[model samples]
Each structure stands twice: as structure tokens, then as C-alpha cells.
Target: MNTGAVLLYHAAQLYCNLYKVTDFQAKETAGIGVYSALSLINHSCYPSVKHYFIGRSLVMRAVRPISAGEELTISYIKPFQKAKKQERKILLQRYWFSCTCEACVNDWPTFPNLPALRFKCLGCKNPLDGRPRVCYACVTKRRDPDKPQTEQMEVVDSIWRGILNACCTDLALNIGQKKTREDYLTVCQNLQLLYEHVAMPCQHVIIMHQLLYKYFEDEF
Candidate 1:
């Protein structure tokens, strides 16, 4: 028999004995006890089969149900932990295909440092110097600039309220209902506007776009 046929035969025989199903056959041998017909099963970054060894006998079980006409798949490696680029490169060489998994595709990007604010002295409204025991102007008046200024507080509270209101309104619209294409598109547009107006520049916009893309793509 050809290599493919041999592998299939072995896989069928092994599957039958392992699962106690009697209808399987091994038609070919591929290496590492992997049979040809079974080797026809493809690799998925996310796989249905859980590959394991039972005392040197290769065993696989369905992690999820397999449907008719669906290609059988097994993972090339562990799912959760992050792997170094070099490690992935070596694995891809062995597998003979480039890894196009979500983890591989979405490598994290660096974020910028936060904006700095000037600290002011309460008594004179002057910028504070480094490590001063007390502001010279504030010491004589027994005033503390560290306390929240009422005007500043009011402005901050108003901005916070506006953001909260927008968020709550969006949640009400989207939650607990089947969203239509128009509804999803509207939400994405709204979110894009809010992020542009409110969030700092150089912030991660890709995450926002990805969230919208996932829902829209799933619809299609």
C-alpha cells in the first residue's frame, strides 16, 4: 500500500480499538504512528481533537463534536501560553506551514507614556519645586493646594458624567436583543466617534476596530 493508504489503515484500526468501534481500517502508514487517511486530517490553530499518548499508543478524543463533511483537526501545539517568535519559527519549520493563529497575528504593541501635569502651590498658584517640605506661599497662610479645587472638581465630574451617559446609552441599545447589520454599523460608528473625541491620541484604536469587526464578520 502507498504511504497515505497505510496511514489511513493504521488510524482506522487504532481508532476502532481505542473507542471500541469495529468499522475502522488502516490504509497507509505516515510517520510517528500517524496513519495516512487520518493524516488527511488538517491542522487547526484551534483543534477539536485532544492529542495524547496512552503508554506509547497515540490516542485522540473529540474535544467537541465532529460534523459530517467537516475536516478533522488537531492542534500543532499547546493553546494558552505565549511562545517566543523563535520557538514559533522552529515549530512552523517542522509543521511546514506558516502559523496564522490569532495569537500569532495579534502580537501586542507598545503604548506611550502618560501625559504629565504641573503641580501648583495653593497659596500663590505657582508651580511646586522638587521635594519641598511646604510651599513658602502656602506655609504662611496654612493653605494646602493638594485639596481638590471646587471648580476643577466640577469640570471633572461633568466630563465623567457625559462619558458614563454615552456608555450607558450604547449598552441599552445593544444588550438583550438580536442586533441587525444597521445596528452594528451604527454602534461601530458611534464608538469610533467617542474614542476619537475622548481618548488620547496614540491610544490603541485597533482593539476597538477589532471588536466591531468580529461582530460584523460573524454576521457574514
Candidate 2:
């Protein structure tokens, strides 16, 4: 019997279906395992669901509101909310599939040191590149009404950029440590103040949402 070959094949199957079992409370890798149901869910960089370990039982919970019939998804990798599309693709290569998640396809800006943030057009509320005074759609609204308009309602990109820059600088002081519960609460509240102004699919918002979920799930 070719025992070595059998073990290799078994390892490959596990690689494709494995889930990193994270200690929700400790926020670290406890181990890995295979789950039949979870392996069926697709991968999205900006996943709709986040999973964690609870004493060998894997629990999947939605990070955002999903519409009826929307396909369920969970990220195959971690800390990718800030990564570029190409970088993310490289990280996900082990899964043997190219990621086309909303964040990846649109190249969503990451925080702490975000690039020039983009906001919506004041006239038509469509996303305008580089803060243009008026977007092409709004300018040619009457002439070409069929132009696509973004549903994301972003404004004050510069303000958020500055806020994150300050945040990252402060956070660097406490690197490799979780923020105090009070710190998370304060951050969440401050984010709420400008929550409405932020565009859909924002990386900072997504990352914070995941953190809050993890915190409350384990601590509370």
C-alpha cells in the first residue's frame, strides 16, 4: 500500500477545505480543521460573514446585512481589508481561485495611510475621481441620462483621511496589543458620528465592524 501517497492526497483535500480555527477570546490561531458546510461558502475579501471557534464548534455570523438569496461568503484569509487587489490575489493563490470581491474589483482604499480618498459628486452623488468639481454624469445628465451613477454616498474624504492618519500614528505606540474595551467603544462612537458620510465598501468601516463583532462575541 502507498501510505505516503495517500497521506499527501489527504493533506491536499484538507488544504482546500481547511478553516483556521481561531480562539475568539484570545484572537489568535488555536489550530485548523475541516468543515463540510463552511467549505461550501465562497470566498470574498470583503466577506459578508466572519467565523470563529467556540470549543471545536465553528460559528458563522454575518458581518453585514445580506439580502435574501444573496450568496453567503467568508474570507479565506485575514488582514486583507487593507491589501491591494494584486496583493490579495497572491495571498489567496493557495485557494486556487482569483478573488473578484467588491473591495478587490473597485480597489477600496485602506486606512492609517490611505491614498488620496475619493468622494461622491455633489451634483449627482456619483463617485468622481480626485474631487472633480462636477462629475461627467451630472454634467451630461440631460444629454446622456443613462450614465451609471454610484450608489455610495461619500463626502469629506479629506477629513476622514486626516482622522485615520492621526489614529494610525497613535496606534503604532501600542502595536501588537488589543485596544482596551473602552478604547474600542470610543472609536466606535466616533466612527458613528461620520458613519453616514462614509461611502459604501469602505475598508476602515469593514475592519472595525469585524473587530467590534469579535470583541462583543467573546467579551460580552
Q: Per-residue lDDT for 56-105 in model 1, tens only?
A: 34556554335798767765554323345346656657556776654456
C-alpha displacement of 123 in model 1, angstroms?
Answer: 57
Clashing pairs in 2: none
List residue ranges in candidate 1 displaced over 4 A. Answer: 1-32, 55-57, 64-70, 80-82, 107-220
lDDT of 1 at 203: 31
* Top candidate, metric TM-score: 2
Candidate 2 C-alpha error for residue 112, in Å: 2.9
Query: How well does each candidate superpose onto the true structure, as a TM-score?
Result: 0.29, 0.59
Candidate 2 lDDT tens digits, 1-220: 4999999988888978977787776778878888999988999877888787787888886656577999999988754456767778788899888888777777765555443334445456555564343467767333332232233322244435544654663465347544455654544554453344444555556555754564444432
Each prediction's RMSD to truth? 18.2, 7.5
Ten-residue stretch with the least lDDT total in model 1? 18-27
The Cα local distance difference test for each model comes to 0.45, 0.63
